[model samples]
Target: MEWIILALVAGVIGYGIVIYNGLVALRNRVRNAFSQIDVQLQRRYDLIPNLVETAKGYMAHERETLEAVIAARNRAHSAAQRAAGTSGADAGALGAGAVGELASAEAALGGMLTRFFALAEAYPDLKANQNMAQLQEELASTENRIAFARQAYNDAVMTYNTRREQFPDSIVANSFNFTAAELWQLENAEARQAPRVSFGNR
Candidate 1:
């Protein structure tokens, strides 16, 4: 009976190790997914200044709209940087807050971009400008990439969260302090709507 007890204990210990390692791998995947999103977001931030510069000459009258986009972009970029710097168990609460802030800032930026594009409808010269057209196309591509990355990151987070919350794995995850990752989400309903712009007529 002593040998039987020893084998049962060894089996439980081995299973715990496996669960712990699986959680660690999932956590790493979540981190990698977040990094991908960070890269896309950085690309978007870099493109914004160029977009605004190209709009300046033709959008002189819409200065407020342009300024709002720049301000929101700056806020979002800063929040993203802060969130990227966070890690480990302490990162759980801090990262969640930072992610929430980033989402709000991004939503604000999206709204400003939408308004700016709407105003651009009246500026035929702006629509006809080759530089503006190119910038618009690049920004659209970056937006699509960001969307894809965000979805992937969220999916990873969902998997990690589920594992951490599962029965037997929960015991191992909690013991190892494997906190849940926050999912990326768009904060604004209006931002979900594609910007209403029609440059074809121009």
Candidate 2:
């Protein structure tokens, strides 16, 4: 009877260890996925200034729109930095509020970009400028990459959240304080799409 009880205890302990390891792996995966998104977001932010500079000469009269784009870019960049824990927080430990702030900032930036492009459409010379065309193409490409990275990050978060919530695993997760990861989601459906960067004729 003593041997049987000891064997049962050992088995339970082993199972708990496995669950803990699985949770750790899932948490790390979530972090890695967010890092991918951070890289793409940083690239997008870097491209915005050049794009605005190229438009500056042609859209001289549209100063408000130009400034709005730059301001939005700056806000989004700051939010990304916060989400990435560059503010001295633990990396990849984004709470729901942090993720929401990042999403809101990004959506605002996308809206500003859309408005900037709509205004640019009026300036035929700007549309025709080779430098503008190149910058637009690069921004469009970066937008697509951001979309893909966002999807991957969301998927990883979903998986991590689901695993942590499962029975038995929940015990380990709760005991170990493995907090839930938040998915990155834009509030506006239109904002979810890449901003229209095409400068071609209508």
Candidate 3:
């Protein structure tokens, strides 16, 4: 009887250990995924200055549009930093509030970028400028990378959330104080629509 009771206790302890370790692993994966998004967003932010500068000379009439892009980029950069930092915290690890901040900021930035690109359509000389063309290409590529990174980050969050919410794992998650992660969402309707981009001719 003693041996049997000891064996049962050992089994429960071992199972608990496994669950705890799995939760830790999931949390780390979430962190790494957010970091990937931060890196891509940082790249996008760095490219914005060059893009704005290149457009300035030819877009003399659309000063507000250019300034809007810069302002939006700054806001997005700050939000991305906050998201990265909040994911580091234990209490709200990947909470909706933190990630939502980034999503909203990025959505605003996307809308501004769309407007900026639409402005490009009106400026023939700007379209013709090699620097502007190159910057546009780079920005598009960075956007693609950011999309992929966001997808990966969301996937990680989904997995972590599933593990945290499921029964057996949830028990471990609760004991360890693991919180649910938030998905990155598009908040701007304009951002959802296809951008009007006609760079060449009319």
Candidate 4:
């Protein structure tokens, strides 16, 4: 009877260790996924200033639109920094609130960029500028990368969350304080689409 009880105890402890390791692995996957998004978002943010500068000469009268884009870009960049910091701090440190803030800021930036592009459509010279075309193409490519990264991040979060919530895993997760992660979601439907970067017939 003593040996049987000891064996049972050892088995339970071993199972708990396995669960803990799995949670840690999932958490790290989530962090890695978010970092991928951060890289692409940084790339997109870096392109915005050059894009705005190129437009300034042609869209001189559209100062408000230009300024709005910059303001939005700044806000989004700040939010991204915060989210990245949280993910880097420690395992399970990246909370839902930080992800939500980043998503909101990104959506706002997307809206501003959409407006900037719509306004640029009126300026034939801007649309025809070789520099503008190249920047637009780059921005569009970055946007695609961001989309793919976001999907991967969300998938990782879902898997992590689900695993943590499961019965046997939940026991280990709760004991170890493995907090749930949030999915990056754009609130605006329009913002979900990448801005139209095409310079048609120009």
Question: How high is each candidate's TM-score?
Answer: 0.92, 0.94, 0.92, 0.97
The TM-score of candidate 1 is 0.92
In angstroms, give how far residue 186 of model 3 lies from its true place: 1.6
lDDT of 4 by residue, 128-198 (tens): 89999999999999999999999999999999999999999999898888999999888968878988877
Cα lDDT of model 2 by residue, 1-202, tens digit: 9999999999999999999889888888888888888898998899899999999998899998899899999999988888778322333246547778999999999999999998999999889998888888888988988899889888989998999999999998888888888888789788878899997663
Candidate 1: segments with Cα more than 4 A from true spot: 87-94, 194-198
- The C-alpha stretches of model 2 lying farther than 4 A from their native spots are 86-93
CA RMSD per model (angstroms)? 2.0, 2.0, 2.0, 1.1
lDDT of 1 at 136: 83
lDDT, model 4, position 113: 88
Q: After superposition, how far is residue 173 of candidate 2 from its true place, in Å?
A: 0.6
Model 1, 50-163: lDDT tens digits are 989988998898888888889988999998898888744443422657677777788888888888887888888889998888878878887888888888988988999998
Off by over 4 Å in 3: 193-202
Instruction: Kindly report which residue pairs in candidate 1 clash with one another.
Output: none
Estimate the overall C-alpha local distance difference test score of candidate 4.
0.90
Using TM-score, give the best candidate's number.
Answer: 4
Q: Which regions of candidate 4 deviate over 4 angstroms?
A: 91-93
As for model 1, its CA RMSD to the true structure in angstroms is 2.0
| Model 4 clashing residue pairs (backbone) | none
lDDT of 4 at 188: 68
